[model samples]
Target chain A: MARLSLNQKTTDRWSVAEAVAGCVRAGLPSIGLWREPVQAIGVPTAARLVADAGLRVSSLCRGGFLTAADPARRRRALDDNRRAVDEAAELGAACLVMVVGGLPEGSRDLAGARERMAEGIAELAPYAAGRGVRLALEPMHPIFCADRGVLSTLGQALDLAERFPAEQVGVVVDTFHVWWDPDVLGQIRRARGRVASFQVCDWITPLPPDALLSRGMMGDGHIDFPLLRRAVEQAGYAGDIEVEIFNAEVWAADPDAVVATLARRYVTHVLPD
Target chain B: MARLSLNQKTTDRWSVAEAVAGCVRAGLPSIGLWREPVQAIGVPTAARLVADAGLRVSSLCRGGFLTAADPARRRRALDDNRRAVDEAAELGAACLVMVVGGLPEGSRDLAGARERMAEGIAELAPYAAGRGVRLALEPMHPIFCADRGVLSTLGQALDLAERFPAEQVGVVVDTFHVWWDPDVLGQIRRARGRVASFQVCDWITPLPPDALLSRGMMGDGHIDFPLLRRAVEQAGYAGDIEVEIFNAEVWAADPDAVVATLARRYVTHVLPD
Candidate 1:
């Protein structure tokens, strides 16, 4: 009954079949899928699996690494993203989340890298729109700006998203990424109707040796989930609330247990009163 | 000779006396001191040492951790900051760099924490100005916003600094922290007269296990130093270009060797042509 969705990465061990069944067993209405697992099972089979279980594919986890320096690589990235759009449409995903790539290897031209990301998005937006799939620009935390994502703020993501039609391109309000932004609330409000997805996770301190795994369970860290949830709701986002945590400990835990814990945390800490 | 200053922490192994002497030996005209080392050698003695070496104290490394939940601790923080002001004045440093503390322990009220920082700065500004020391608000990278400093953007720092007179308050344009900020160039331009100090370091990826030790030498990471240097110079900030790296490897190297490498990198990668 709680409109909570589990992002596949949160349960790293779960295969496409396992994750779909786990969501059904956990009574989760939706699941956010990654292209890897879905591709591993083949898109049509994966789509049928989720549909047969009567589960919504909340959003596809990623389709952007568009900042490569090589022309061939950039072209390949665009081509691959087009395939991801088709996959999202086949799966009936609400959006295709993008983790825009960081600086090209050994290059420090952040502006140039950002320009490349915008260009990639601009070229892909029409293709995605044609298939009725939205492009969700997930501005990662600034710490990941060097290698993970060049889009470092919701404002920046919105700046790019605003250039496209709201249904074609929008921004993701991932708490782990935008909670530290002083202007996040304003950006969230500004992103009204352009919010393609809302993801939840907590930010733990003394980050892991690998910064990528620093996201904790919703209630385990400093993020005020209810506060963020309220902001997203006020921004006109009445969509599946995806719990996307990436941590070694979380991944090591049993997938069903992780889903149960996420559901409980969502009701307790994230659902608005 | 360029307007370069060697921040002592870049050569973490050097004593206060040795750092001053090393700066002089390296033909560096200025040195930035940390309060711990200056207090270790006694402020007066450290001041005299730098004076004897014909070295200017570019800026003192910090004087703000005011985001405390407890009233008594807040008062103590203000007291310690006052002492830091006295030290900066005694050492004839240009400013007292403030890395305003992050969320108070067990507290998640980021807005409250940032308010505490602003209040602390407002309370300390007059005291610092009275002693002829400017308060340099250093906006740290957003990654450190949870535990180290909540001031995560130059724009946020300036928003706070603009509250006080420019002589009493200013912002530090540290390359390592602000390079990931998309609007950094515009913020630097806006920080014109209030640009208290300009610090340089690189942002290498796969950050060290201890995030605090991740600052790399100028040429070793992804920052466009000359680009930043040009922005600062265009902002009318004719101040010492301090090389303040915080890497464990850099700290382990010989202090003289570290200083020598920093000087060379400053010329090759940082100094605007």
Candidate 2:
């Protein structure tokens, strides 16, 4: 099994400087960094800080929202993803995670939006591969099907994976997103080598209004961690199970306390001895 | 196709009497009745009113909440559903829909609770079958994955359907509960003869906090109803497209307006002309 990592946004209270320092201080092995924080601290400085602090980049925070029906707007999204891929390459991240966008704004045509998403990602896949950055398509929860991601199931991601030909394009296995899927176990088995990232977080019972980012912390919700961990591992994903929660309450707490607590919980509850 | 039906609770303003008359005024073929107005007006009187008003009963409000986890509580739920089955049978309704309960009150173990739901449904299936009330399992949206219904996917309902091994235990496809599914078209195909009921509402873009209910009226949200109707029709389901929108605002409006608008929309946007 690979090591577990901390996603930076989970400890959003800290700036990039404090976050990296605190992660290293906590003796964690791997971490994922988002674009905003990296840009805020400067990519070179952030990369140097991560290297100086001896932390491995599990994956870069994300790079795709390719569902605009307009060709030029789609091209612009691809251009932005190109920048993200460059950033991921700089950080030596394992993968450039992509969150494919949902229905094109104001468009009730999900099929059209999904088609646009596929074309947009296919356009970016080669650019990402050229830079040695693995493009990871993250299928978010079905609740985000209309507003956040059209690829709301792992099976949909697997279908997308088939179009990649080679394993250059991959999928993300986020427990918070796919935990409720009855076909999750089957899709993970099917994903095997095509899975580029594995994310862990609790699926809270009752989600709040801004369901897009109101993620629950580990052990605070109803997902079965051991079962999910076993499924992802059995699927041949030897990658860090990055904790990527977005709880407002947790983010408002002390950075060190949050990291320490997450590290402890991830070790005790998530990681198998 | 069975004629379109207007679900009364979608227009919660007036009483059941008003909803029935509104449906009649609009020339709707069928209507979904609620238990509230029945209780408010006494079941016998409400039954006479609906019968005299000449509205075809598509289905009785609901039954089954099988997840108390405790046998005593589960038994109470069964008792309630048994009575509901009788009520639905009395109404000359086509089916008794069940929104099988989520994790037991304040419980977190979803898997175990789902097992309890299956067992409860299996028990109720026989009684409902005997009473000539088709048992329709309405798999809810994933947003209600924790405390409402663990059976968040229609595939899960089909899997459960295999256990009862009868026409009695079937599914009710409500767009509001399943529009976000990446595999909805496939499931509708899989549903085939097992679809005891069919419904239409809409998936609003920014999902409301209260998802179990907050369904938008058909054509008001993102669901492509004609496409969905075509899929179900292709799957051999020649049944009523009962519009079951649970929005509080829709309910608080003029009941007649709500019914009339839905009837008009069904004719123009959803149903095949």
Please report the candidate that would top lDDT against the real structure.
Answer: 1
How badly does each model clash, as a count of residue pairs?
0, 1
The regions of model 2 sitting more than 4 angstroms off are A165-167, B105-108, B162-166
Model 2, span B80-174: residue lDDT tens: 89988888888888888888877665565667888888998888888888888888898988877787777898889989986775478889888
lDDT, residue A183, candidate 1: 100
Report the C-alpha displacement of residue B28, candidate 2, in angstroms. Answer: 2.7
Candidate 1 clashes between residue pairs 3 or more apart in a chain or in different chains: none
What is candidate 1's CAPRI-style docking category based on DockQ?
high
| DockQ of the candidate models in sequence | 0.88, 0.63
Provide the lowest-lDDT 10-residue window in model 2 chain B: B205-214
lDDT of 1 by residue, B131-232 (tens): 999999999999899899999999999999999889899999999899999899999999989999999999997888889898999888899988989999
How displaced is residue A128 in candidate 1, in Å? 0.5
lDDT of 1 by residue, A1-273 (tens): 456898999999999999999999999999999999999989999999999999998999889999997999999999999999999999999999999999998998999999999999999999999999999999999989999899999999999999998999999999999999999999999999999999999999888788989899988888988888899899999999999988999999988999889888888888856
